[model samples]
Target chain A: MIPAGPAGAHVRHWQRFTFTERVMRSLFYIVVLIGIVWSLQSIEIIPEFLYDAPQQTADLFVRMWPIDWGWYPKVVHAALMETLHTATLGTILAVAMATPVALLVARNVTRSVLLNSIGRFILVATRSVHAMIWALFFVAVFGPGALAGTLAIAVHSIGFTGKFLSEAIEEAKPGPIEALKAAGAPPLAVLIKGIWPQVKPAFLALAMFRWDINVRESAVLGLVGGGGLGMALDTALSNLYWDQAGLVLAVIFGIVIVAEIATSWARSRII
Target chain B: MDASAPIKPPVDDAGVDRTLIIRSLTKAYRAGQPVLKNVSLKVEGRGMTAIIGPSGTGKSTLIRCINRLVDPTAGEILFLDQDIAKLNGRALRQMRRRIGMVFQEYNLVERLSVIENVLTGRLGYVPVWRAWLRRFKARDIERAFQLLDAVGLGALATQRADQLSGGQRQRVGIARALMQEPDLILADEPTSSLDPKTSVEIMELIAKRAGERDIPVIVNIHNVALARRFADRVVGMSKGEIVFDGPPRDLEDSHLLQIYGGEGWLE
Candidate 1:
């Protein structure tokens, strides 16, 4: 950065931070440094295992190579269909359940303080816990299967979709709503006819983005034996069949790519 | 008349046909300071009545109060043999269907097509499910198209509202209000956002519509010239109170001075 001669000679540097901002910046770095150290200590990092990981991974891959084409049919039958079904069903259910909650939480739509706070609380509570933890809860409740996987993803989605969608509704233009209500449209009608049009494009984008995330999340719900590609991968890993595990991972990757493309296409069309 | 009575549809008394009767209406957005203070006016049958005042003098508040958009702190708004001040829920909705409102901003849903916005005026009369599906009766669709044609946007019916010019959008707004098939119309400075020429055109259109219907129109306007030209009666307000109430021909510089204050602007 060059100092512009006498023109700005008497002027102080514009890049200077305020007193509080300077203090906050220093404090943030210190807190992050402390967190990293604490996490490493708490997890009991094994230096020896970490050092050997790369070598072990390379050796395993070498033995598993020569393309396990025979394992492709097994992977497709075992987990591909289940993975797709779980994600699609979970996303649909989650969006459906989130719709009412989103409306109640939107400040413009909902005037009640209690209801708005309750809606916010549900979103916060659900979102704070990840899909993995939700899978564990449903696995224990439903005895572990595709049912548990679907329910887990759906529950987490309620929080995810609700938070974004409600904000969109709140930020929507109030002009159309006033026009509709003045014409004697009811509250529900105001939502569907007046508010819906304003938020449809934004909501479509948000839902499609969430659906893509769910596809990735549902693939691994089977780690807890909820039944998908993750469960098949787990089985192959346990028996030390690295080639079979590689095949299952490849299938999961293919499905995720396909889902991502489809969602992108759908989002563009609607928005 | 008792103010505390459970207000219902009023029974016809004597020979006078009152389309709307307002008595002692006041509004306060805050606790003690009222924006509209004890405003009372009556409209018999039809024709346009323009309310003119300085900015922040509660001209908009007065018109909004009649439709219960801004609930009056103390008032009785009798329209079509019913007390508008007391209706709630379904009853209020039913009453609103009979009244149409035009805003200064011309608040048509920008994402919707011109014709679709005109049809929105019938939203109050249709079932919720039917409205969601955009299913209007054949008659309503036909009327919506006719209104678009009347507004001279017949070819632009499929165009989005945001694509139209300010003048064109206001025309769509006027068409939307007429779509309600309302018994009364409340226009809140319907031309305030338009250019001078467009303003004149809008006022003329409104006068023509109200004249044809014989329904009363209570308009809150800022332009004295436009109001006088279009209104059957001109109402001048100052400091949230009516200062002048008579025909437009009777108003002069003295009345304008009193309503808006300061003599320099009159020249």
Candidate 2:
């Protein structure tokens, strides 16, 4: 028999390079090229602007710094509550609507391919429109209030929550459902007993996650006249009350932090 | 020793009075590729009737057809004189309450407590609101506890299903089935996931309890030895058709070869 070292070398010589390694190298080069392009675009080093450039942005930031400090308390109390209310209403309505829609969208759960396709199309339509644009549309219809913001957030969240919930439902073990069916349980019973148990925790966790995101989105809905803390922030900025705007920013930051912590705690308990 | 002994049969033959009848049952997932073709069999009201078959031979499909899990494309399934194939919605659910099923994987709701998982068997009997609220009647809870005790899982009532060992989970699964107070128990590869020792123990428990209750069991199994050990009658399937139907003693090596299609492994 040949020595172990020479035998290993012979084996190595016979082995061909894998397709995966070649693909990985190509991907690395493409990623580096894209990063360089993005960096150059971000710094405006390519002379792409036509008017009112990055200097205007810096000027606006400087002009919006010193806000009206005395207006802080009122702004924080009222606007903060509105933001929370929008998030609460939006998340609740979104979760309720998405629950049924997700059942339709999930391939394993939905028996009809046509229905599943329709459900997926609806989700795509809802998600393609950003929350801000949805807020603008709702403002056009509902005339600028928390209702508009709530509707905006609800529509956007339905897309996100429906997709996530459907994925969770699809990935659940098929064994329990089969067992239920064999036990002579009806379709609805199988869904309740087998599917619901597997998906409930994930659905709850997703709802909590959406609530946190909705709070942040609700704060900005006022910028598009959909009504919330964003309206106050926009007003302060337009009037050059930089100190009051600064205070509002601080309050929004605090609310986001608190919402994050609460959502995280709730998620931990559930999963 | 007396306490551990299997329950003795009473004079009343309530279990023997019931029967399941199937006539020309046929199931096709697609237009032409039938999983069960013109299959017809009857199960006696008591004792274990094991269905032995190779993989992809429609053994599961046959059991599923009995409960209408996969709707038969043609023919009739009569359970206690009712045309079970025609049942829909509430009628089907009510019928299902009396037919319990045990799975290969011990399909307990993993996040639920063993007792809570067992309580689900009562879903067909309990009102929807009651099930939602988990407010099963006091009698039902008592019965659930009793069944848990009978299945030897009394102490594991509060434990999450995923925490239990495979044998322990199967015990809980049996208890859950018993909680339904079903007239028939259908076990689909119930011991396929277990080791030989555990499989024997589980099969013994299933056979003993089912016998005591006088409830008939239609078990789909791959192991010929286990089937011979426990089953009163064996039904062998090959390529979606029943090739042999007889007592274990009558199931000769030639029949096994005919059913499974090779004699190389019989040695």
Candidate 3:
């Protein structure tokens, strides 16, 4: 063992690895960097546009201003209302569906391995895919309306709410469940009396949060012919009515801000 | 005979068979290392029997075995002539309703109101679907209110369980146990989480209630003084076997040394 002056003296003092390791790592990084550059180049991305972005944005805003204030009464009566309808309907239906699924997915509550895994896989699958794709699928099947938008949001909510609510169910206090069981409460009774009450606050909070997100997401679903304000925005942009599109953006911004405030306030009070 | 007097066979319902018989009960969480080693004890109708031992001596397990909460590895627990150890499904559920348990932790559903937690004790008697609608029978609700009053929590019935102090919560726990109208009550160190005064109060409540109802109670107690004070019979265990079984007056310091395995604490 004492044969060497220092075991790693041959390696450079500044380097953490041997020469071969250093060369191989540097070469690997160089290849990765070149690959990223090549991919960016292929996409025809203009890095220089970053400098001109502010100016272009300002010009776009100028075009969008001079509010289509008169057109608001006409659009608000139908499209904006439809967007709200889609979000509310989707949230109601999703919560109805997610309650049982969440119980089945929670490791502490679920009885069977096969059933639990299937529930987990379904949640993971739905969560992994984007809502836009769900909208497209529903649109293709249902022929593009508030129905498509509602179904899309509903399906996505199952993933979001199911995963979060199941975790809350799992984290529920075991003492209460044990007490309930010791009282000879049946399985269903135990769920209602023991588990549900403990997780209810968290589930309510998540449900409201999902509804908030759905309102925003539903607003844009119309771009892909699902319905709502996105359709109105798409139409205005296509017809070169920049002022109308600007009004739609303003409405969306206003609604989202209000919804966030409302949801958080409600969550605080309820929880 | 009075017209309202119910017809009955020539037998005493007051002294009816509420006796619990256990034959060679054994339990092991893992393969070979057993927690209870072929233990057997019988509890007669009514009054309190306390099991006292050092920590981890399978006292809780033995109490749980009577209710079939922890399955005995090899045993027969005969409650009212039926072998509960062999029962399953609906039969087991029927058995469990008659056996109430109190935990070391009061284990109240903290978010629920005191009255609602008390009503959960009737879950076995009511259909599951009825609970979904919050539809407890009127009599059960009225009885729950009575139990709350009996437990000295009548004013706090509407309060959330977590809002109460430790003793108040344990009072609710006792009310819940009584609500079951159980034939046997298992108190698994019911006073462990309580202060000394509260512990004595809880024991008195358990003993008084079981006496009123003529239901036998098995308690896994840590405090020997409380055991001697409340328990009609004291069973001592060491290394998962019952080493002493007699009336409370006979549980001498020498037996404590044998059961708890130390001489210094006796002083």
Q: What is the DockQ of each candidate?
A: 0.70, 0.42, 0.65
lDDT of 3 at A49: 94
* Native contact share for candidate 2: 0.47
lDDT tens digits by residue: candidate 1, A7-124 = 7676556857998999999999999999999998999989999999999989988867755668767664658778778888998889998989999899999999999999999998
Error of 1 at A131 (Å): 1.2
What is the number of residue pairs that collide in model 3? 0
Per-residue lDDT over B1-267 for candidate 3, one digit per residue giving the tens place of the 0 to 100 score: 333455333212443477788889999999799999999888886789999999999999898887777888999999865898998877887788888888899999999999999999998889987877889999999999999999899999999999999999988998898899888899999999999999999999989977878888899998999999999999999989999999999999899999998787788
lDDT of candidate 1 over B55-166, digit per residue (tens): 9999999888777777788889998668999988898888888888999999999999999999989988999888888888999999999988887889999999989999
Off by over 4 Å in 1: A1-35, B1-18
Better of 1 and 3 by TM-score: 3
Per-model TM-score on C-alpha atoms: 0.90, 0.84, 0.91
Model 1: docking quality category: medium
Evaluated with TM-score, which candidate comes out highest? Answer: 3
Q: What clash pairs does model 3 have?
A: none
Native interface contacts kept by each candidate, as a fraction: 0.70, 0.47, 0.72
Between candidates 1 and 2, which one is better according to TM-score? 1
lDDT of 2 by residue, A1-271 (tens): 5557754654425435578988998999999999999998887854545455787777756765665566866766787888899999999999998888899999898889999989998888888899999999999998998999999999998899999999999998997777666555557767877888899899889999999999999999999987778988998878877777877887888999999999999999988
Rank ordering of all candidates by lDDT, starting from the highest: 3, 1, 2
